[model samples]
Target: MKYVTRTCYLGQISILSVAITLTCVSPNVVSAATPTLGCDDSMKTAFKPDGNTTVLLVKKVKKDDPYPSPSKEQQIFPNRPARFAADLCWVKLLVGPGVPGPTGAPSTSRGIGIEVWLPEKNAWNHRVHALGGGGWANGYEETVVGRMSVGNGNLPAPRIAAEEGAVTATTDSGQQYAGASFAMNPDGTVNVAGWRDWSYRSLYEQAVKTKALATAYYGSPPNYSYFEGGSGGGRQALHVAQNLPEQYDGIVSIRAGASTTSDIAQLYPELLVLRDLGGKAPSREQLEAVSAAAVAACDIVAGQHLGFILDIRRCRYDPTKDAAVLCRSDGGTNGTPTCMTSAQALVMNKVWYGLTIDGSVPDPALDNGWDAPVTGVRIWYGYPRGGYIRSLQGDLTWPEMKSGGPDIIALALGNPKIGTPDFKNATANGEDGWKTLTYAELAAAYQSFRAMQSETGGDPDYNSDLTRLKISGAKLLQVNGLHDPSAWVQGLTEYYDRVMAKMGGPASVQAYYKMFVVPGMSHGYFSGAANPNANPPVPADGQLYRALVDWVEKGVSPDSMVFTSPAPGSESSVYKIYPHPHGPQMSLPACAYPTVATYFSGDIFKAQSYKCR
Candidate 1:
């Protein structure tokens, strides 16, 4: 059959089509069937837009296909028929009968959420395009279609699918709890059922069902499949590439979290330290100032201070050496520019060290100012390291251990004798005395805090069986801002190293994965400097997404990408694209683990000024 190609332009919106034809005898071709509309009798309630609404489209399929039979590995239940759902602005297509629920009853089938963009007219040239990331729950089918629209306005999926002459879908990964943990839960008991359902199984099932639904709906399967996402969504993209390589021709995983479990565990130690150091809850302004000062002090070396610590690798601010700036005690009071106190520094030191009391410090060379000793000056610099400190009132004395609870107030004002020697030292060192408090105690305290803060569960290593991904020949790109204290860039680096190690070594893993470290970007693309006008709304502007698209479609890997703080009320911005580190031979070699960017020549502020080897 001949299909006409058409182009439609609506202001900034442009839809272009290329001519194509389809033969009737193609493998897996299906006759066009009209969509049936009926309310589920069991769920006999009027559909309301108040909560999320899902519409299921079912297509009968002949049994003779090459799709994988449900297996223990795939975790999919037996195949029933082809069924797909149309949610707001997206499609959830599935291929199986249904999986067993927590009660062992046949549960509603779960599948991937693919965005379908159809042109106004039917044509054989229709293709499939995959949209990528924005946290697990943030990116919606509507958001992606809107961005691709001509003038940055929302476009309905049906019109888009028709206009692009394509059917597209995204994977919600089964049970829809945002992250995997929530998806696997069925029981009130820590929601374990949702967690299991959401893992790799949901993703796999969605892929299979999406293809089936497309073929059933369009009378032909998708011509091509693509995957894209950043951060948590990036992790989902990696899952597809690894587990279902054949499901997609091109995969874009930007800033993907390869080892999310480890990342969460790592944050625990830091959180504990902050809690112990009297920094549980500081105002946003206080946190911002503290972060700014740390960036300033650590942005450069003594001779070449860059006024910003874009690259944590080059920062060498030793708390012992630059004591005034690194370990001040002003506590954001009395007009002090710093954000931390000595006690807080000790807590942060403990947190950054993973709460391990082995006394082995992180390599100072790679530590930046992150692992510096806690000092009073550093306390006023940012969020307190150990936790929040409460003001002592009226001859405070230590409360009994059991009665004191986990509150910082008891630690601050309770019996002085019960406290550690470092606490005493902090009180004695004039203003900076609190800096000497040992992090060891705080680390132990987290045992109780962990029990109190959240429910407990067994440590489940999601990456334990990454062999499927490895065999699938998926490529991964991970990027993190060096100055990001939220999920500290070091954690991402560490995760990459661990994944490589598990896969044998860099030689074995290099082809499948790579990581890029952005020097100056903050968490969610916030600004590193203190300028409010310069801060750009993060995860916007498609910087990370563009990088992934380039890598996947063009085979052009990004050694470095550019980032800049937007100028206030101006279209122009100061941007810089950092390059991969160069060796003495001037060869651009990938950075080895545990090392950061170092400047051998030029100005430290410029990315061209240094190399990471």
Candidate 2:
């Protein structure tokens, strides 16, 4: 990693010794050149293909091009039909897989899909941006068509950038939808090449491909490139920063989850145990009550009650201390929803502390005794039940019909190279494989899972080679919601700490990267409110995205990110609401880590009342 002197400055020292210090800066400065390609130019012949890469489409779309109305479920972009008023060149490419990934990984020679939308010369902003997909996403066609459906997955970049004359692109990550495991070979082994693409290679491939297409289409490469996404997308953003930092100048990761394999391996077993608890198992409502109680008891641990705790580490309210409120004489429901039964209380505490049994998971390669519990209902108790069942237990009915889930289980169990019969036999006869599995056996299987995940670049390792990112001076913004259950918030905080340690401690990490912790927000978005997805689940202000752009292009680091929700009874402001659609509007500021947002005084519904302490 080489650092170049960006600007020269001379400063005199006031000390007795006369000495001058020289500082080398490398901040991203945008170029002012305009694109030379015209809307009616011959872009088709200009795009030169890479190995196994086929340029599928290169056509100009008028401002009045007919865009179909998005179905109700895909209505995240309400005004997307006419949003891109400028002439646009839509380019689609099919990059053949055999491309080798990060050193030693399998080659992705299969078909990897990519689409780059570029504005005409008049609308061109001399820049490019990439969109990220959500949970186990196999494709990103929805983004190109202007319909982003994940939790706050709808970024302003595609619409705003295109209208502003910038280019944007997305990839299918080699597979087509949520079930990326479909890329497995027919013999029940991983299609290493396809899996390689799914791991992290597709992003790099897509970026390289898009840049080539942009150069051919616009007569020059972009001045700057950016990437943004939430959840799985956030993980991809981290990958770009970690493995391919030179590709993007700025990156935004919202509620980044750990490796998919890691989450599945750890979370699936916890769910199985929770389900096997029989009647003692707590309901989602009961779990939420425990969380509320925890908030009430621990939120004040930092000296002020802000309805929720910004820093959970500062508060250690024990669930056992509230036994009176949980345990009734007969272990029955206490009538009030706030109380729990004795069995419920015990189970809840176990969840709060996560599974600590001897065989819960394989030990980390670089263990610091940070094997903490996956608490609360959101990550475990409140996750999408169908997703768990479908991904793991082979969609088999629970309690009675247990055997036969998916071969992916073999991968999760640490036997990535197992055959279909071996996979079937592993789960065919017992209580969903849990009954016959011993601690030693489970630990071995988990070890295999981790090894394969790392080889495939799927394991969310604590450290990465960030020297390139730091040296290049790319800006990285990572935001995690404290209450997001799908991905353990603690794990992310721990990862950031590890990055700090690996990179050179707090100051070094803070130079080019910063993390913000949002209070009361869920995995990908705010879930406590009704119709959280009615609008992009993130802050309506899009401050994080704007903040990254400012940092990258203007060298302005945002001090605070203010998040806002629609005022109470204004659910109609964005889209339709269902289920429980009533809650007070909220406005809060998520300060950089270590400095938590504290409620001071005045209007609590406004962010001005909160200060980053």
Candidate 3:
């Protein structure tokens, strides 16, 4: 695991005096990482009884004890191995699948599974670090999509906290089965309680009970608390911040583009693009080649070969125009090693356009129009060109995703009765025709979804006015990859802009909430395109975690950070997710959003050679 020191993330700070230079952060220095709670099931009843929550198992675990592995971890991190950090009292609890009315207790619906790790007391940081789940998971994975579902959460937020001597917890979010399966009912009706548990209740209740359990273990409540997650976990971070402002002192959300929900919504169109027109999406090879071609087309700035698209929203590379580069194909299985069939190209175009009124690409220039985050431009976002190809056609590789579009529409509309809305054949009025939905129809669906959700006591997607979070002095830090295929940076920028306007412009928001949009990084990894010399992405869960701790404990906020990539062929791949140093030759400075890492005259791999302008 990463043992990053205090001076690790300040982005090559040799420019100033070495003695007084502001490293700008602190390493997680817990004297004793795990706590020793010497008790058994009897200790479970020691804490006050939760309304409908049950402490299923309470076991004492030793540091380095083998953690129960998840069934499929490669889905989250195709290449990384998994490891659990520090240890102590491992508490597993179940929350009601039942919610939404006077009878908010357990019912026939599926309940949530939560795991809390109370670190060894003497060395504990007296902080509660609650982890949010990913994908369809209410627990870890896009933050599954963790347990072996999403990359072991790319070695998630909880591991870092637990190892560093902070109290940590994770949840299954009801659908331990993961995804939208829990939202569907036998009679084709909406499972309101299941939806509530998956969307908000599970995560919220997980945090509430987690804190309560921590309080019981430590004798008093924690001095500070933070929520960290990416992808689905990213959504959880924002949900807690907006709905229960007092729950967490900070939110480290990633991949929460659109500032609404998981970019999972983007999958619907891309899936339809391939399924409807081409009959099946292009093979993985074609998708990767298309991404490479797009990267090559846009990787230059002022004649400098930067290897990755700098400003993705402004990227003008079009798949339809790749005829000169990619070989020709017939849209079905006719594609060759480097050839893309006309139908395949068209599918790419439609996917890029997303669920729009007409199948047309939005102008790159008009992205920053007068409207904040610009509503009505399109119903949902499309995957970014040159984004991770694996995320493209490979998303449906998971069995949970085959019917993704229909399921999303069903859940959002809360109409369990909709029963697999037609994709290829949208209805005349276009109520649930997700694939063929017109812009007006799509907008109405989104509105209807929001309206339905609002009636359920809380609307996590809306309410950007985080005046309460700010008043309580809670900080929010978001880290996103500019070219993330699953969660585009466009939505993140829009959300930041909206919150900035509501909370007194950029300056005020930056005070407590700041976002770092990493160029070239894809979902937490670097671009798939062969950029041998590009800087490795900043450790999202590692360095970013330190930055948040510094902000909360030391009052130090980061302005820019140095990104370090493994040498040309040496991308660091340790079994543990801890942030260790990677070497050979890769270092670049990624500036905070609104500003990008602009290349200047010098060594391409050095941070000093680039200006954040």
Candidate 4:
């Protein structure tokens, strides 16, 4: 929680800030030196593992090792591939084995598995960066641990950090073996220890141990630390900032995931709407068409037909009654193969408005109020109408269903643990789970999940106070793509607003934290035209990482971020789109919250043409 002071001076300060006064003296790190320690088995003894943490493995990855070290190198990464991580010492730990977590939680037979990759001695950057896992995955998927995984997931966070000369680590939070199944015991009891590990304990231990081991090797503690992640990983990043400020000096949380209750509540509405269709759901093309129509209707600025909508809230064209989308038989004029039927439009309408009874966000507010029945209650906000509805529509077909709505219901119903028969029996017949469930049952499950948010999901932790971080001299940079569907934009904005309320207001919060929204970007996945007429989706590059480093080091706050789409014939690489104003890039200006890149004049492809107003 300490920083190397540069200089602190006082002057006429606005009542809103002394927020700035404190921020001025904090620089990310001034390293002791690049420390080098031998990388080998002997280092295991040198680690001096403490508490219930046991160092299980320590090895060096020689330079030119195929990055990520896949089971089969060609399976995921092939050809010239990703940045080959070289010259590093890899370490793994079994943390808090058989340990009972907080709240008198029962002890687990297994311990949390954590992996750390530190650059070789002279290569060490004197900084520690931890990666967060997606979904139920922590960081590492190691067999040394007992429970495998809730979903056997891992992210590229640690690898990327090691590549950057950082001492990095990821904790599997004891989910490496059992995946999502770890939450439910064989006898159908909730695994409170496992839940605690995944949600809270694992990350805390990893930070303490990762730093301890780094100090062991480096002969000095790191001057600064950072954590960056997107999606579930993003949630972990926030968790550290909120619960363990001493862990990292800078946090870049992108498209952070919501609570389990929010996840179930937000997804159920779509499942319900589709289930009611009785196998008569709209085709993928129809869903895409309506999504396109929403963009087409909303992307206009002044006289210009801008590519993407700056503010979706202002774009009120509803598909259910829109003239351009409805088929002639149902009402309107469009005769294209993609025209929507009344039924299809109804589905879109439900998805847009979400499953709210009073048009409030469906996400449960943190309180005793959430323990009641979910009927006629707000669940969470709808997926904003964008991202080509690709992730959603592909999930529409029962045979190839991709959404986790049914599973969420199962998990939620188990409250405080995976309910025994319900987890298996409900989702047993696949989509039939959606067919047979009664509204009352669904509501009860939603209620159950909401109540369990503290133990299972990091809702209380993730959404709680940041006074610790704000005062820690740390900086926060959060980004969300305007077109992202995996994580809710409205939800993120609401979280920011909540933080603002907790920290006084936007001005006070902005002193040490900032958020940016990318236009035409979606979950860092697609990189082509989502709607050809609108700005195409593009990959999010590491430019934000540089911004975070500079912000933490030089106090240069980002007032605006530039988002880019590949221009025709542009070099087919990410860097061409990054570092700003590279060759033939079609980019847009992405401003800080409450401000959007408004088109002023000139070529739409030029970011300079738009101003943050």
Candidate 5:
């Protein structure tokens, strides 16, 4: 919606005086400063718009300083051209060529100055739609626009323009800060203002504004609108669906968290555990041992020939008993494999479980690949202790490896917890309660990693508002990579369950939501032979993005999309897409809730390999 600036406190005048003055003023009196338009001339020109849909060319400002100043370090690789900085300014760009209509030529408009992406267009018979991306905290106006250009060669406004032959606008949440405000200091400390602006409020505000802008630009409200994002962006998709459902007709949240706090909190426990190990780096032996133990525990359940636990839901390890085997390897040289020590095992277990220190049992249905035992060669480990030493450069020195532990620990402690209701009661038994520590302790630790999280601003209880999102008629599609190493796939499932519970149950939530699990995809996208060391590859049958589009546009709800590995031939270029039934069944009916996929009959290598329920 178009924003109008109103002076809330002019020279500290009392509200009563302002109200009285307003009553006495003429109805036509105008006093606010005129809105500015256009960017500097030195930069590339993108279109800027006044509150109305009028378009003008504006110079772009770089999001950050061209070079690292004394306050900031230089970007490691500055390959991309610098961007325009539009902090607090209002700018607009023209997307797509104007088309002559019955009345006049129609042009699409978008806001560029603020962090959000807003697109709008006006045509009598046309419609308007807004798209949301993941990581609302991160500055994505450029990224989203760039990706759109690369993938579909149409900016959001133009894409929507082409799709519906209607006008459209998108936003980057009008935030000045990049997502969250917390940036690490040169010495690796958190920056505060950076943190607060980057919190959930930015994304929430973006969603709200998208609807407002739609109403303002179109004269009439959008007939139908959709929100889409994957991973962190997926979380934004869920947030809109859960918190502002009536605003949009469809939402595609691919791999979103149920609670932002819980998701972030879950990473710390493992980081803490790893830090306690006090090694320069886990020896090759240690990595192998932990990987091996993990596989043995859950690989069979994955029903894959690779012998790795492809999912996290099925992993079931008793920390007390599995702890020993988990850390059989500890300190060793780079060349030699070593057994994990007790302390090391504890850390690995915690990492596998996420940062949740509480006693809440993990959902049995989520097949976390943590339990897969490491039998094959270890590909790599996290940053070597001292600094980033490229693998191609050779093994890192012991002292260098050791240097990373403290920082890793600090990051673990300081990371923000994913906000979820389950976390509140995690440690109910006094000192032994599931979550045990107070919110203050967690906040302080999170400050150490990224100080912006300590601001305690934004809607911490946003996840609890799913009912409101549903009431608004939002549809959600959640996707996750089963083998995601960054955020556990289990966490995504946990978030989905929380939404279902908040809405009563699966059947009740079914009208608004759907979840899909990608077999071999990584955190971002499918990595293949071009990037062998990537975390996960899209299976032979996966077409995750296409599936999302189909669900959003064609009204064909995805039950299960197929995944296959690339064969050694030209035909291997083609993907095989399959559909699995939704809900529990005897023969691996992608079971719901507590039911897990377990082997019942037939050869494990075949699609008839196992059953879930």
Candidate 6:
């Protein structure tokens, strides 16, 4: 048999081939032999929910075949897997008239792109895995068809659900993977529907149709359904757990940027501090020195000796205490490379002390209440000694450094001075678009965007309806990296506490949901000491998806899991390696909340040397 490739108008050739033949049944039509049908037809099934929805294509993908995007311009990452096999279904959803099209122009169809991948009959595992995306962007089809199913972070062969023999799906949420292009139309009007799709609707709609497609393909419903993602994907998982508890059996969020409110509160304060210390920002070496000194001072402060502080809450190591070593005697310039300038010291101290304007603390007060005598700022990143301070790019202008460059920032700060052109260009190039707005204006804009996200379900309040999830018997596992620079660890800790307070208590929350804190690990994966190229495999340590499956199918919950760090200078390290007192490769058993990993002597590099206390 000869196979030919064809490209769609959007210039995308799905990772799952549209050429492979499939035997499909039309909606409302039934046949037993449909399960054994071949992929010769394109439109084997038609799903039209209303006048607005349309099922564009349905085809079977054969195993061990090459599948790539239609154009090289597509931003799909990593690479295609060695063998791609699945039943591919494509649908175009309508968000009503006046909805912006791909070019940000008006169109009636308001085409919301959605794709689903199902394992071929022989490889079907009777389960479903839905993937997620990062930043303020919608879930991407590139992820669904991309090499890694769980995500690129857990990649390097095996883990992408389809390859593991489960059904998978992703949607553009009425927009492409291009950051926040869909947030605002060219006319500067808010794309409410696009925001809806980005927030919760896109995932909601795709999950619904995915189940029906699964049943239609296999002739029976899946035994289990799950979601796996990191960062923004984690936020989406929380959204599903709250809004659509019935669709999934299990869900896991890795290093989740769960609260937009916190992002708004702390993001600007850090930017402001850096803004004041222009040309005197701390170098990477200085940042590492601060982290090392902090760890050294706090290592045994609260009955813990470790690579990274296991529980930052109990350990209150002050950076200012080591100011003599950190600050230059002259307080001008020409000091030791390990020390901070007076200006740099002031900025660092302010960053540590979270969001404050004119000595007045902001609402939803900083979550660093555990810090005894809480000296300065004590923000999220300030808690853990090596909490990714080096990751902050302060070289950029104040405007560029704000909000870490999310497209949603553009929408929020876009006013008369910094209009659509600036927003669009700022996203493309690292332009200092915020200079156009006054301090008051910028503050107002941030609040506005934060409110919009909250109302639209983007900035989740952590007040998720977990009771509904518990009632439905669904399982949720939230794994947070102690050194996550983007999301505040203290904030997340507080949110978990609120869950316990709102619900019954730790036991009640634990029955349905579990939060695990990874020691020594930074955002995504890896500790400061691990090599970016040689970092340890995340799943090898956490077994996230596998754990979810066990809990959903066998009623088992993850307690203590040993996670390893990638070796120095290895191919697996995807991020930069910072200095830490620990060895090149380290392992630790991350424990559930209220319990910390206590050091017990002997071969500190191995996880078995320590016990979860």
Measured by lDDT, the strongest candidate is: 4
Provide the lDDT at 545 for model 3. Answer: 66
Span of 10 residues, lowest total lDDT, candidate 6: 1-10
Error of 4 at 99 (Å): 6.4
lDDT string for model 5 (362-400, tens) is 332342333322113211112111111111112422221
Which 10 residues in a row give candidate 4 its minimum summed lDDT? 145-154
Ten contiguous residues minimizing lDDT sum, candidate 1: 7-16
- The TM-score, computed over Cα atoms with residue i paired to residue i, of candidate 2 is 0.74
In model 5, which runs have C-alpha deviations exceeding 4 angstroms? 1-131, 134-136, 140-170, 182-223, 257-275, 283-289, 301-306, 310-335, 354-462, 518-521, 527-555, 565-612
Q: Which whole-number lDDT from 0 to 100 does residue 90 have in model 5? A: 23
What lDDT does the true structure give each of the candidates? 0.37, 0.54, 0.57, 0.58, 0.36, 0.54
lDDT of 5 at 39: 31
Error of 4 at 250 (Å): 0.6
For candidate 6, write residues 36-115 as lDDT tens digits: 32333433444443344556555555554555442111222244244444444322333222254544332112555666
Candidate 4 local lDDT, 1-613, one digit each (tens): 3433332322222221212121122222215664434577776565554556677887766666655444211222244244345666777877655444333222234577888877777777778777666555442455221111111122254345445788777777666442344554444446656666676677777676777677767777777787766667677777777766655788877767655455555454445554656655566677667776777777676666555566665666666568788899889898999888777776665566555543233222221112322235655556565444533555423221234445556555543223322233212322334445554565566666666664344453336477877878888888777776666676677777788888888888888778877765665523312354443434344666667888888877766456666554433232211112123446777687857777788886678888987
Local accuracy of candidate 1 as per-residue lDDT tens digits, 1-613: 1121221111121111212121111122355574422223211122121122233432221123322122111121123221212222233333222344443211222433433333222443444545433333222322333212110011222333433445545454443322222321122122232332333444444444444445544555565555555455456665665555655555555445443323323333334444464445433344444444455565445374443454443444333233443334433232344445555444434333443433333443555334543233222012222111111111111211011122221122222333222222112211222223354443344343333222221111233344655664545555555444333455456556667778877667656566666544443343434423223222335454455446655676545553444433322222111111111111112243444556677644344655666
Per-residue CA lDDT of model 2 for 213-253, tens digit only, reads 66655565677888877777787788778766777788888
**Which candidate, 2 or 3, has the higher TM-score?**
3
| C-alpha positional error of residue 114 in candidate 3 after TM-score superposition, expressed in Å | 2.5
Q: Report how far off residue 59 is in candidate 6 (Å).
A: 4.5
Ranking by TM-score: 4, 6, 3, 2, 1, 5
> Which ten residues in a row are the worst by lDDT in model 5?
20-29
Q: What is the lDDT of candidate 2?
A: 0.54
Please report the candidate that would top TM-score against the real structure: 4
Per-model C-alpha RMSD: 16.3, 10.2, 10.7, 9.0, 14.1, 8.7
